[model samples]
Target: MSARVTLYSRPGCHLCDEARAVIERVCTEVGTTYDEIDIDRDPELTERFGEEIPVTFVDGRQHDYWRVDEIRLRAALGG
Candidate 1:
């Protein structure tokens, strides 16, 4: 399957940094990969998630924003 996780973020976002750490750890433990999209690079994404960076999508659906919950992420990924 393609990567089931997607993180929408921009550079220098502290929450995005934190989310990345959590996603990396959880995805690694679950043997799954993820995609990271820089919202700043896309006008649509920037408009959609400008105020809510660090957004996460699991299985093509919105999962979380601003912060990442490790347990919830693990559960979502069926880790």
Candidate 2:
């Protein structure tokens, strides 16, 4: 089974970078698949998450923002 994760982010954002590292590691360890969407690519997404570029969603539900918790992510993905 694939665990789907969505990341709302933008270019040149340090926080987003950190979040990516955490998500990437956890996702890889758990065999979870993730989509990284640049909020700037979508007007609606930009308007909604512009201020929180590093937002992460697990199964379509918001999980964290600005920073990612590796342990929490692993638990969420049932890793």
lDDT string for model 2 (1-79, tens) is 5449999999999999999989899888887789898999899998898797799999989999988988999999999
| Every model's TM-score | 0.97, 0.92
Off by over 4 Å in 2: 1-3
Q: What would the C-alpha RMSD of candidate 2 be, to one decimal place?
A: 1.5
TM-score (C-alpha) between model 1 and the true structure:
0.97
Q: Which candidate should be chosen as best, given TM-score against the real structure?
A: 1
The local distance difference test score of model 2 is: 0.89
lDDT scores in order: 0.96, 0.89
lDDT (10s digit) by residue, model 1, range 6-71: 999999999999999999999999999999999999999999988898999999999999999999
Residue 74, model 2: Cα distance from true site in angstroms: 0.7
TM-score of 2: 0.92
